[model samples]
Target: METSDNATAAEETTPEPERTGIAAQDWATASAVPQYRAAVVDLLGALAYGELAAFERLADDAKLAPSLEDKAELAKMASAEFHHFERLRDRLAQIDAEPTAAMEPFAKALDDFHHQTAPSDWLEGLVKAYVGDSIASDFYREVANHLDSDTRSLVLSVLDDTGHGNFAVEKVRAAIEADPRVGGRLALWARRLMGEALSQAQRVVAERDALSTMLVGGVDGVAAGFDLAAVGEMFTRITKAHTKRMAALGLAA
Candidate 1:
């Protein structure tokens, strides 16, 4: 999982912040706009449900672990994911939004994504947890740039690594080295995850009008907006990060 200095630099560099046109504002200022409030609720709801789902998936995947040590590691990560879900749920309630109602709209889409991409073995499960979760985290971090400062901090906090990244990289690279053919299978699996993950994201945005509008048109006068071209660039950045992650796992992207 060694990252070259060049790769680290590239990872650190992002498109200019000015392009987002979003000025930093607190939740009080940003949420005063009804549309913005609704958008924030929807965003939090989707995130809350995603974290909950991650907790469940990690716990279930732990059963497929080849050793007790691996099982324990995943259990710890699962607990962390649940805590993240709790934070998002509490945040929604604190804002006077009903957590269940906010999350309901996202349930089917997220559930379908998991059902479709269920991993077949321990290594595949590890790849799913690492690759799938990282993609979602990257997308959220990009969107966080447009959010009010308070919400942005909460979003970023919940997206923290939870120590799974290095664990997955170590185990997956070792598995590949022990049997090089595993690399081909995992590389393909990672690609499938990339495609499904991106599609699920697009589906969510298309179905959620307030959230989509928030991204495309900006919320109220407080936030700047993303043009269609900017959205394209966002996905490009996500794709590049995915490639780097694949490389870290000793797989071809």
Candidate 2:
């Protein structure tokens, strides 16, 4: 009878694993380590939301394409974006944050950014998609390793492979060869779109601590509050890549 009682007591007292997508141990360790856990969590949450929002925005923009063929290509690009978004959402769930909540803060800012600087024509639409997606892919790839192993693997897996080379430079080059004047205006528009995105991105960061932490979460114990240098490197890589993209397309500045 005492053995039976002991068994029941043991069962009753045993702790269950956490369901928050965060392990209690991992959470406790991460959370207790100053602001490390929250910073990482905030970043994960923000990024997950960003992916979903980009997918939706790109899908809407796809409709503005002038040609049916271009429209279809844009739609395909949007589909790919959603695929990327879903992977992010799944990873977010693993960390115990609601996808929608993660994405809410920058929704309006992202929306307005897209709305205000919407492509004036199909070619411009292509440029935005081509340029934006390329930069985003590169950024994600570089920073993906910063994530814990599971997340690092997840980011890498989602990036399987794609063709920015064909779509951006080749397509843009073909168009330019057809009509050289188009290059100048398209190049100007690309720069402007990039500028707007950068400004609003900073605005969004300034407004959200969670996002800022996530973006610059841990930095060699430099907890001086988010490493601007590391983040700037990501931006620098993006700018350099964009410059290369512009040169390939024969666009000035």
lDDT leader: 1
User: Per-prediction RMSD in angstroms?
Assistant: 3.2, 14.4
Off by over 4 Å in 1: 1-11, 15-23, 222-226
lDDT on C-alpha atoms for all candidate structures: 0.83, 0.60
Residues 1-253, candidate 2: write the lDDT tens digits.
0011211222235464232222223443445454445555555555566566666766776677566876676567667657877877776677676777767765787678778877777678667766655555555555543444455566656554334335556667788899999988998898987777667666765676554554553432345465678778667766766676666667875
User: Distance from true position, residue 14, model 2, in Å?
Assistant: 48
Residue 126 C-alpha lDDT in model 2: 64
User: What RMSD value applies to candidate 2?
Assistant: 14.4
lDDT tens per residue, model 1, 1-253: 1122222323477554653333377888878788778888999999999999999999999999999999999999999999999999999999999999999999998899999999999999989888888888877777777788799889978987788888888999899989999999999999999999999998887777667767664765645543567777778888898888888889899
Candidate 2's displacement at residue 5, Å, is 66
Please count the clashing residue pairs in each candidate, in the order shown.
0, 1
Q: Model 2: residues >4 Å from true position, as ranges?
A: 1-34, 159-165, 210-222, 226-234
TM-scores for all predictions: 0.91, 0.74
lDDT of 2 at 136: 52
